[model samples]
Target chain A: MSKNDKKQQVETTGHEWDGIQEFNNPLPRWWVWVFYVTIGWGLWYTVAYPAWPLLTGATEGYKGFSTRGQVAADIAAVEAQNAPNNAALAASDLATLQTANPALYSYAVNAGGAVFRTNCVQCHGNEGMGATGYPTLSDDDWLWGGSVVDIAYTVSNGVRNESSPDARFSQMPAFGDILSNEEIANVVAYVRALSGQEADATAAAAGQQVFLDNCSACHGEDGKGDRMVGAPNLADALWLYGGDAATITQTVKNARFGVMPAWSEAFRDGGLTQAEVNAVAIYVHQLGGGE
Target chain B: MSQGDTPLYAAREPIFPKRVSGRFRNLKWGIMLFTLGIYYLTPWIRWDRGPEMPDQAVLVDLAGRRFFFFWIEIWPHEFYFVAGLLIMAGLGLFLFTSALGRVWCGYACPQTVWTDLFILVERWIEGDRNARLRLHRAKWSLNKLRLRLTKWVVWLLIGLATGGAWVFYFTDAPSLAVALVNGTAHPVAYTTMAILTASTFFFGGIAREQVCIYACPWPRIQAAMMDEDTITIGYRGWRGEPRGKASDPNAGDCIDCMACVNVCPMGIDIRDGQQMECITCGLCIDACDDIMTKMGRERGLVDYLALKDETREREGMKKTPIWRHVLRPRTIFYTALWSAFGLAMVFALFVRADIDITVAPVRNPTFVTMSDGSIRNTYDIRIRNKNGEAHKFVFSQTSTERLWLSVEGSEARVVEVPADQMLQVRVYITADAGSPAATAERTVLRFWVQDLESSERASADSYFTGKVR
Candidate 1:
């Protein structure tokens, strides 16, 4: 390289003892311009947004934008979109709601999936498989009734609750005072035969008249049970009290009444809207047995 | 320029940060892999917490105000556990810094890791130091534009991922991922992503070293924490001075290779002295050693050494042993302080209660007289249930006045409270009027609540009163 070609336009720090040399050049033009632009941008940002904290809160800047306000607006927008389907769900009856609007039904089912996971998964298994005491919602047989209206009614006004006037109330009588031990055993045999389970033929034969005289008032003579009274159908495989002989005998001797505190009074008195209850009922209904 | 202007020293130029390879680099790579891997994978793991609770292994349910780890579930009132974790982190940082200077800052700091990642992306798209410098000096071209755009896209994606991972800590990760891809994630997620993306671009991409040197308080605080005995990345002036190139055969051991300057991320020549921007990352040591090996010179031109030992060597004092300097009074004190805080936090967390109570008295009209010659007072009581079941809160006050307490709105004394919900009730207390005297008598009234089935009893206290009779 020629000496003139190496004439350094920018002088170095000149104390270089090795290949490393410090250039005394000014800052690059683009970098300095960008630095200025950034400063200007910072000022603009401070003025246009709530950047500084004040004694009360933050300054309401020119744009008046906030993280909270933005979030609220976004949530409202999404809710507005879902409002029509929610309205349709509110207007229709439970049975008609499912069949009339396919889209709404699909949406409700999807919505119910999460709500069930949140609320009903505790006692009723995650998938609505019953535990020892908890009744399964997935089966066709129900302690109450399986019809959509019946299911909805039972859910709204739970069993054995005096607060709701319409709750299907039936408590098996405590026959300890009325019937002898032998009679209680005979009745257990009669109940077993009614369900088509194993039973002593002779005792069941003698106990048929006893059931006709006492149990037929709530439970029909055919043992089909009165839905209004919430007596279980003795003919069905499902047993509300129990199928085992010991449990059956004990139940007959001293009644077994499981209390489900009224949910309607709680929901109504608690000031929750019908839509909210319906949302929850529909959620619970879909857990196992919903058609 | 005047003599005063030229008197002291030159402002340090940016370190061109040359690349190097060694055992320390390998260790750093290993740690980076392990930490980043854990962060990305931890959210997807599931735990079978029965059918009742959420299944995500590690989740912070913001709406539920519950934190779920694999086995331990934390409620809002039990926030001491979180505080304990933060305290442990602080202590751990102190202990680590006391042993090795700025090691955490150099390697594990989020800023450092992200900056390293940004640098990698920059290198991939814009080429390394010399190539970048040449390109910058060159006029703008279509090729340069394409490279710059590609680099920005990658950087933005990394920023989005960072924001994405952060939101996962607040919600269920897999569900959020699905929601995000389906455009169903909360708008807050998008906003957070934007903010994070901008920050990553500014901090990691542009203001890299400025954050460490001028903005961060850590380097300033660390100056006070360090002492003469602390091991810092230092150039051995005793061996490296009288600097000259190896071509000049009579030069000192340094050979004036400039390898150290080339490899420093901050661009400061280590031979000048330690500066605030130096992260003590030991890259210079690696660079210097490589040069030394190539030049047939003994290594360690730049090494981790104590200031006292360096000074002693300069003053012709006998060289002190390495182990003697490590166990100083400052390190011992720091260790003790760190442990004390750690142990105290652990102790507090274990004993902290899940349930907390706050009682408010109706102050507008403090007392009233019933027609039956009884004094009455009203209280608004709130009960919160932390357990996963609806509980019955029974009302009975501790006043010996046969204080018949009854809730006004509900008939039954037993009130039902849902899981993780607070139930507020207005309770009225009445007593035989003539038996109580004075307006401001302080009598502690106890309210006991039992989970009827679980037999778990929780008690709270309030006061009973009557006007002067």
Candidate 2:
């Protein structure tokens, strides 16, 4: 509107569209210079880096930078950071490390947790709480010893832990071989009473002598059996073969010893170290009920 | 007249783009060769990813829910990487559009390149533009019959190759190739090939320029992005109008050659001014330049220029060339946006992780109480192993009373996860019956997993329900 404003160099083309006019203004000064700079830079970049596709390959740029090299450097940095912890795990005894160093024990536990999910979680639960037949580690009761060392040994050798005749050797013999049918019936009644199952008083009393003579050798007179022999304590009320009349009768007659595969073979085959297993034991103990 | 004033009822004419040759044509051919070569060959390339990972160089294993690209293995949880890649591609398009108009559509678009290739085969068998036009006009001949049959055969072959190469990206390429050759590929593979073949033939061989003009949204969007300064393939009307025969005393520089129209792939006369169908491939410029040399006139009768310059020159005003208009505000804004997005994507990749966890609250009876006076909640936790090696995860929780985690079946707190597998199990968390809120209160708990050797820990949060005391 002003004379000075009208003197401004910019001009709009005379031709007009609906309501719009084309400003015949020159591009911004900064924009033009930057465009030139980038064009120059692009030329340099093409020379210095891989830009053009060749018949057989690509032209190697002068700078020699590569995504592969960058990735390799990152992996190396991570590896360097992990070196010390890896060494510590390789050197220490699992049980001692767990009891002596909480940090190291925790690391092992964490490691073992990962290992468990990978190898053992399919059969065992994710947290090592056993399914129907699988034993739960979060309880005070343990079939094998609950001590870290005891657990390590059990994991290393396994239950029925032997490779031969004496492997962790423990079994309850069949009372049916020596006792009469009536006597076996009475013993079954007495065993039920030990587990607080109902039994006729007369039947249990009649079986007492037969139990004392035949069963009391491994099972104490009180029916608190030796754990060393794996003869479970009857009074404690945890039944391995089950406290039912039929199962008890069958167990007493045939005797029962379940095979627990040796953990050493599994350990070696699974590619787990002894210390790693110890860490898992300590982690299992921390699950709440270890003595 | 302004574009809006043009008659709306004007019938649209079908275009059969005639083929051309020269710099841009050769450039398009080179791009097609390289892109199709990579597409067909990449799946067969091998990578040494040790023993646990897939060896295909580029593969999307859907059943495994993983993607393998050379040394990089992507787990399903890390799908953000793929999203980031798509963002980068979009940004790349913006950058290219700001700098060079429709370069992507002209040289790199899959549709344009393939259609051009198919058209080349058609021309090779049926002859050039004029000959084909003349043949269509003439009565049926044995020569014409043979040419048409040959063209169809070639078009089908190209379609089959394009479709056959696509399935290789989804599975082990070499093994799948053997299966295909032996007639034992999966039925799904056969179905995919059939579908792709039909689409390629219909789109690239038949539809051609109709896709660029009507079927695509890009041309409309690109029109919005352009400003007065934007360079499009244009005709210099000042040098072309006041039309007369070439030999007339008043004849303008154009010389009525029509060479530009003959060479256009979209078959539009650049001299008629910019149209929606121009791909900006610059073939018309090459053709018109060649014509100008013969007529002994100044070149660029049809050229790349802005609407403002074209109008001003026609009105006899001195024109400011391309360099003067290169630094506009729109160009600067687009450049800055593209750079910022690219940098953000790089930063995100650095912080992104390869590990993830999801917790599911038990559906049936969410909370349970034990005989020993403890309140318990059950959850089915699914832990995914994203790395290449198997790992163990230890579970722990924090609550009012010391919260104990028991895996329903296993005896160990350590859950071992196989590489690239999801481990699911029911976990029971119990707090002593003496807790402050014994009946029902939400308690926030944390589950942490530490890699035994690396001591790296990952944690997730979930709530446990208990009876209020």
Candidate 3:
């Protein structure tokens, strides 16, 4: 009962260092039980989940849980939930989309933005501000058209590609084989003059008659390129290729051939679905370009 | 000592503090009523925040990612205000602890308040100290079982109410109360209530002072905040020494009465001097004062005394004034720091603009050469309207050189932003061909959005990239 007697009764570990002796005290019973419970939980967890790696794959535990499988299931669930909306989007008329069904229009735009970022960003840029060769979708200039229906058709069939039979097709003869170098140079001067760039006036006047003789069929008599033929307007400041004198001369000689692949699943393998095509077309149309 | 017999842990010895009445005890009761009343009643108070917002005076709307306190609404981006408040709370604790010792631990701590309530319930059902002690040691009988079950049920109800009051802070109190009674609340709500109830019951009713001594970090931290001038409860060993019966003329003013020990919540003998286990609740002071009055002797045998004052009093010198103990440099510094944070937060809250704008220029294909020979830069401009009603915002540009500003999807450079919503629009700033801005590699520009209704405006500075001509 005495304090000194109680101190003397306490046990110490058999080892001593200098005058210090380690007390041989037991851990708290609750802590010891919790440690045992954790060990049991670890064994159960290993049995219930994929834990060990085998020769070809990991062990398929009782629960058959895999993070990869879980992620795939989650994606599938979301896709299934959106199936009705996607179906409605594919069937909705693009012209009446904004007025008749605003919710569907908003959904299409958001969905289309996602699709465009994944597939079209490489050439069209993140905000659809096209690169030098690619046509900018955010601008008012359009070679074919800029309407929602027009954009949808262009996106589905593409331009001058062999993948789709209905692809917008246009061909300009390589005038290099017919016209002399002097004649090609004069026509380049006339084309530059049409776009309001500095050019040789005499050579441009001479080339105006030559333009009427050959290029007028596709480029129109006024040098305003026809959209039906998918010809770019020479008078516009936008150019698919460079509008400098040298670049103009090269274009008049060899002509330009831009090929866009079809995006519809019916036209190519691993292509976009009808809903995805509509979505992307709506997304591109809303980028300030659609007329 | 033998190697196998040493004990590392010991079971807790339960404390049964007998009730006492005095000035400090009355103050503690008043504080308990005020704090508990605020906690249980705050969520039920309503304020008019218009029809579009929740009316709760205080709400943590996790679903909306906002904290609504009276007229102030905090967005996630304004989390620094909450952080400032928390820092102020910490400094306030430091100030009080350095000035008056563990006053927070003794009177205002949630653990102390709830434990006091639980002990009151126990005393009501099982009788006070001696009766409760007898009940604890007696063999299990029908009468004991009835009393124990009654006490436990009341404690459980108090715990339930504590947990129930907590959830009302997150949602509308009346609706959540209805849903709770109808068994229609969210499963998470039920789960949170259950968890809080269990913790309250265990910590307040069962663990009591053990939570302060073993679990809480505040008691350990308070040691660093206290110095010689800090006022704390202590036994006047100089006055009450040579303890004996009242009739003993040789004894000092001290009759060896155990009243102080009997009323201590931590069950420590105050006559043994200051120890870390003492929360300084002053219940012992109350008990000793009552005993001293009965014996017709002077009181303050156990009282709040500073370490320096103890030494001065022992040497027969006058103790310093109470204000001298409180107005020291450390407490003043903590008070100043706490006030600075509060004032800064208030200034920021009042000066914050209702409209916020951010401009992020498209980096890939930084500048586009338009068909008209003009240079164009695309920006993803986000405008946040914090107003209660929609307003049309006129988008304009200011630059050193001439530039044309246009908003996508609108003919005029105007956008109608919905109230309390953020709208992202594609903005185009174009420089005419051969213009100074077009020829420059980069042109500095400020994009401004002015509310058409109120003329309130906000601007963000961004640079437009041009083709290096």
Chain B TM-scores per candidate, in order, are 0.87, 0.89, 0.96
Give me the runs in candidate 2 sitting further than 4 Å from their true place: A1-291, B1-19, B244-246, B315-326, B398-400, B433-440
B24-117, model 3: which lDDT tens digit per residue? 9999899999999999999999998767778899999988787989988888888999999899989999999999999999999999999999
Per-residue lDDT over B68-158 for candidate 2, one digit per residue giving the tens place of the 0 to 100 score: 8776667776787788778777767765666566778877889987887887887788677777788777788898888878887888888
Model with the higher TM-score, candidate 1 or 3:
3
Sort by DockQ, best first: what order? 3, 2, 1
lDDT of 1 at A254: 79
At residue B412, what lDDT does model 3 achieve?
Answer: 86
Which structure among the candidates has the greatest DockQ?
A: 3
**Which candidate wins on TM-score?**
3
lDDT of 2 by residue, A57-115 (tens): 88888888678877998989965775576578757765467457756766776766765
lDDT of 1 by residue, B1-469 (tens): 3223454664545434556777566666776777777777888889876555678889999888899888677877778778878876776766666657788888888788788778878887888778777776778899888887898889888888887787887787888899999998999988987898889888887778778987888778777667777778788888877888777666678777778887777768888887887888877888888888888888888988778878987888876776677677777777787788778866776665434445676654465544233566667777776655666766666754467777743557777776656777667776665564323465667876666556666668888777663
lDDT by residue for model 3 (A44-106), tens: 988999988889987889998989999999999999998999999999999889779978988
